[model samples]
Target: MAMSKFWWKSDSSKDKSIHWMCWSRLTAAKCKGGMGFKNLRDFNTALLGNQAWRLISFPDKLLNWDPTLSYIWRSVMEAQALLVQGISCCIGNGQTVDITNSPWLPSIEDPFVHSDNKAISNQKVISLFKIDEKAWDIELVLDVFEERDAELILSIPLTENDKDTWYWRHEKMGHYSVKSGYNVIQASKNQPNTVDNSRFWRKLWNLKIPNKARRIQVNAQCPVCNLCDESAIHSLVTFSFAVECHQFSSVKQVAGDYHIFTEWLQMVFEQSNNRDICIQEDGLEQWCPTSSNSVKVNVDAALFTDPNRYNYAIVVRDHLGHLVQAMSKCSLGKVVSRAIRECRHQRSP
Candidate 1:
């Protein structure tokens, strides 16, 4: 509450200030048209959930904990449910996975089977596979499960040699991350928001201005209008001067009445003509020739996250701009061979 007070009121000291927006709205993702603020409770649960994921994924690395375990471990155990909500198992041999009990489907939202067939109640996932081939038995799957469930089951890729492994459903790399866990918690809360404003927030934040100018000083009465309370929304949207400025712009007129500053700004952006856009190119640097006897060394670097490596190249050129000495290397483990192969492939085209 105190944090929210500070965020909303820049000049707030002793006197009470009006809360124009709720804390939940303020904490919503910037994409969802709110200031992206971390919900501490949800974030804490996500952090604990990471510990829970480690226990579930690599149980050998952590010590076995009973009721005698520390409070922190107990808290992490409590957040196991939160971790469970965002993770699923990638099907492999399918021998150990229970068809109905295990979350081994390709889909993230509904991984568990909803089938109530008592005959296959205790059956394993292996039973759904074809007897002769390693693929799913199409006829048996269609007859046993619903159309949606059958499709999801069939879509799951199975590695005949590998064992079933747990994976984070939200991540493309199938790794449990704190960021993905926090987003999952945020989604579960079901915030009522429509239309993404991430681009709007980005542009607004990117405006070339001092950081202090972004903070609004709340005033009891508008200095210009001297009619109502001075807030960002009121000053920017409801004020006569602002409306007149909008009206005079290429936008022609204020499209509609808007109480929120963000909504008004978004509407203006949507209604504005793209043809009226004026591009201001920054001053470009002119290339200067090297000294008659001196050589210039040009360097370039590329970073790759897949293998966690960096590749750099250095070229020494004489005053004539002809390459004299060229050298390149890959760092952070010996991925130089792979980097060379990729660079050749890219350079070929």
Candidate 2:
């Protein structure tokens, strides 16, 4: 209620204002037309669940706790139920997973085997694997289960030497994240996503405007132009300096008269040429070799415009500067800076 009130109420006003949308809708994802505001309760639960995930994933680090323990530890332990709902066992050796009860399939929805066979209900996932071949026993799988169940079981890849481990089903990399946990909680409510303005949002975010120009300023009146209000559109498009920049830039004739900022941005994007700009600073340090007995890894990535692909290469070298391994791959996707952010977040304590 406090969050909702703060969102709807103005800084200058103490009087209550009408909330334009329900709290649930307001907290929905931006693609769904809401502002992507986090529901504090759900967010708090998700955070606690992340701590619980750490406890489960690293049981060795766990300490004995009771009602007398710290409030934070007790709260995290209580959120184990929330974490359990969104986690599934990734099939490794599959020795510990129950065939009927365990969630071991390569799926998020209905991960458990949907089988009526009373005979295999109590069996473990290892029973489905060929003992000698380190692979799924195809004949036994086909004969013992229904078609869908059989197919799902066959689709699961196994690492014969590795032990079964629980993973977050909401993420592709099988890693638990607070955002994914929150999404799982949201999914349980069966909230309908009415709008999908993802394309518009993506384009708006991908605009090549500078950070200083993108941010909203307190004063609306243009300090330089004096004739119009200063906004993203005005500063980036209509201001005299911006006009001069466009004239000087490779994109020689960008118009500032478009009715909407998106249209103007779209025009700028469409008309813009793929011109590479490089700035080199003096006194930049060069790569140095690692310490003795250690190996160093370096990775570089490039974004290609014509085919919309990201190509990356990784190289590993020993302390002696001898090449250990080198590999490169190309993938079709948006820029991978988001992955970098995820990696940083996951590594945070």
Backbone clashes under 3 angstroms, per model: 0, 0
Clashing pairs for model 2 are none
* Cα lDDT of model 1 by residue, 198-271, tens digit: 79888886789875665686678865545678889877666666666656554444478777878777776777
In order of appearance, the predictions have TM-scores of 0.55, 0.52
After TM-score superposition, the amount by which residue 119's alpha carbon in candidate 1 deviates from its true location, in angstroms, is 2.7
- Candidate 2 lDDT over 1-349, as tens digits, reads 8888877899877896888889888887775556789988888999989888887789888566765767867888667777767788887777788998877777767777887998797888888777776798999999999999999888877765578898888888888999888888876776376455778877775679886766574877766545578688777776656766666555555655686678887776766655522223594545689999999999989998868889999999999899999999999977745434544565577
Give the lowest summed-lDDT range of ten residues in model 2.
272-281
Model 1 clash number: 0
Candidate 2 overall lDDT versus native: 0.78
The best candidate by TM-score is: 1
